[model samples]
Target: MKSIKSAGVIGAGVIGSGWIARLILNGIDVCVFDPSKDAPKSVEKVINNAERAYKNLLRSPLPKKGVLSFLDTVSEVAKSSEIIIEAVPERLSAKQSVYKEIELNASNELIITSSTSGILPSDLQSEMKNPERLTVAHPFNPVYLLPLVEVVGGSKTSQKVIDETCSIFSNIGMFPLYIKKEIPAFIADRLLESVWREALWLVNDDIATTEEIDDAIRYGFGLRWAQMGLFETYRLAGGEAGMRHFISQFGPCLEWPWTHLMDVPEFTEELVDKVSNQSDDQSGKHSIDELMQKRDDNLVDFLKVLKENRWGAGNTLKEFDDSLGNSRIDFSELDVSKPLKTFSTHIPKDWADYNGHMTEARYLDCFSEATTELMAIIGADEEYIANIGSYFTVETHIRHLDEVLIGEGIYSKTQVIYGENKKLHLFHWLHHNDGRLLATAEHMLIHVDLKTRGASMPGDSVIEKMERIYSAHKNLPKPEGLSRAVGDKV
Candidate 1:
């Protein structure tokens, strides 16, 4: 499938705004339109969300950011976008009217998709000028981070559209579940709705408070679900007997009165209040942003571990590996005169010293982080390291150039000092927001066997990577701070 160059998001509600953030952060140019006067504000909120998501993504490898535009009309966005996503409301008429406008102005080649929650694509496609191009691309909330998207195509939708949409979602780091036949609520949500019904019954009958019910799941099954889905977990539970055993043992519960599957609990104001209070109590003191950050932090760390094992959802590493196959280390060619990627980071409270300047240990840590980022660029990520059971980083020397205060913006730059088989020496400088070089660190790294924890010959693939960059920058002068070398010659 061809890469999506640009996308358009229609509507600025939570879902649409999330789509905007996700698209832009994935480096796809996005144009958004919503008639509401608050549309620009909504776009800004999305951009802000993207920025936060971008930071979270940095904990792993992610695509670069894309250009984002806020358009005044739906037609304007459609005119410029290769893929147009309609996130207008769940109302049938409102969505149909928006599709009408889209059909009038959109290019025939553009893919038009809806983010409708329950509305079937077949129903929406009935009025479309080109029903084959219309499909449902249902996504979870805060779409920038979550990795699941359900792609439901209508009766008239073409195979080409379905395949293309699947590829697009996969490229953007989301798992796409293609629905061969359009169904209400799609797959996951339908399963979730069943649980939701049971949950409501439990709460309505006072068998469990909302908080207690959530705890029962969050503290128990949620952990398993995070790593593997229900089927896999149940398969494990069955042990050597496998899924059939587990199912046979529990399948009889389906007929039990414990679940009021057909009952729809009344959405009364009192119930809402009770649920709200329970949710608030469950959340404790976390603000929305705080909760978002917590989720991001966990996802980042989780993905890092997945990347290590190359397990499920570790597809991000595979994507990274593919990119690194063509990965060019251009740092030597780039003027190390300036920071290549600059982002403000306040000195963490833990990094402070007795003199109130940043601690010596942290100075080394900051430069170490910069070097790790450089290694990431050159393909030293977890999977690569795990596969070979080898990693780089032999020695380091840090010199404090100037004092750094806690909570001040700290910047960093990596300069290539030397490169060879299984080894690359680098000099990294930590700078204050005021442009002062607070400290500099020089490091010598050797590829070592992770299993034995001993120095080893660099792998051929790693050596080739190093040779290419070293040959290119052969004549360049050594970086500062490397003039003073440490260690006894081996």
Candidate 2:
């Protein structure tokens, strides 16, 4: 499949704007078409919000953001795009008209997709000149952060279209789930609809409030479902017997009429009031904007934990991080005799504690990032650690010299104090942008073979590079606190 460098988005509502943000953040220029007068501002707002969340969510360096153009017509977007995603309302006539306009202007090779949550791809492609080029690429909300995108093809759609769409989505850090058979609502939404239906019934019957229902999920299976889907989770619940035992135990529930799956509760005023009042009582203190920020913060924290475990969505995030390419420093141009300026960043608001200064733990985090950058300089990057060997910090001594307020700029200068085949000793001085020394960390790292999980010597190239750095700094005067014990200075 041809690489996509540019994309087009129709309708600047929530989903469409999110797609625009995701594409732009991944370095794909976006051309957007929406009839709404506030389209440009709306899209910009979503992009800004997405950018904020990504700074906390992503640790790897990102490509330069892509350019965004607000166009007057769909034909203009179609003419310029390799892939066009139509995210207008779900009405058939409205979407068909969009396809007509795009088909009239776009090339036959241009891949066209619809963001309809449940509409059939076949129906959406009916009026198109080249229906085979169209498919359904449905994505979840907050599209910039969530990775799931359902790729479904119509009856007339070619396999090439599905494969290429999946490829493009994957390239942009999405986990594209291909639905073999084109079905309404695809997979996730159908499952979600069932739960939604049950929740409504529970509220309608006064058995549970909306808040209670949400709590039931969020505090329980919601956690499990994030990492493991229903079947696997149930399989474990079945104990040693696996899926068969699970099916036997839970199969009878299907016919028990325990859930109102076949019917939706009436949307009467009373029902609406009950649901709304309950929801408000549960979380009405926060405004929509505040809630959104909280949601993003919580997601980042949860994803970070999953990242450490390398499970589920975390694996997808890790893959995306690896694809971002290394940010290794080119040491050949630097004066290795002086401390290498390896890391620099501004403190974020979330890093502050009740005292308004950066939290104590964040000091170690800053030092750790500096150490990682130093490793990158010595030829130990993500790929190197994955394929060859890697250095693991076995010990660290940190002396806090000062406090840093939120939004203050800071940097770390590192020196290689000692080096050997399997051992590396380093020191990092953390300083505010104004040259005030804030902290210092001395780290001892040991090379280890990831496969064997045992100590191992690094490659000859790495050893040579370390030696060069160590030689350059050997004659330099050591800092005062270099080997001081943790207790009193005496």
Best by lDDT: 2
Backbone clashes in candidate 2 total 0
Candidate 1 residue-wise lDDT at 250:
89
lDDT of 1 by residue, 1-490 (tens): 4579799989888888888887876779999888788877867776675565454343333356788888888889889999999998789899889889988998787899999988999999899899999889999876776667889999899989989988887776677888788779988888899999999878877788888988899899987887788899999998899999999998898788776778898999888887788788879688987887677657656765666677766665446434423334464464433333422355644457777677778777777768766665565666778777455677778777688775566778766666676567777777887888787787888878888888777667667655565565555665565656555332
Backbone clash numbers for all candidates listed: 1, 0
lDDT of 1 at 252: 90
Model 2, runs deviating above 4 Å: 1-3, 268-283, 325-353, 381-458, 463-490
lDDT of 2: 0.88
lDDT value, residue 358 of candidate 2:
87
RMSD of 1: 5.5
What lDDT is obtained when candidate 1 is compared to the true structure?
0.75
Q: What lDDT does the true structure give each of the candidates?
A: 0.75, 0.88
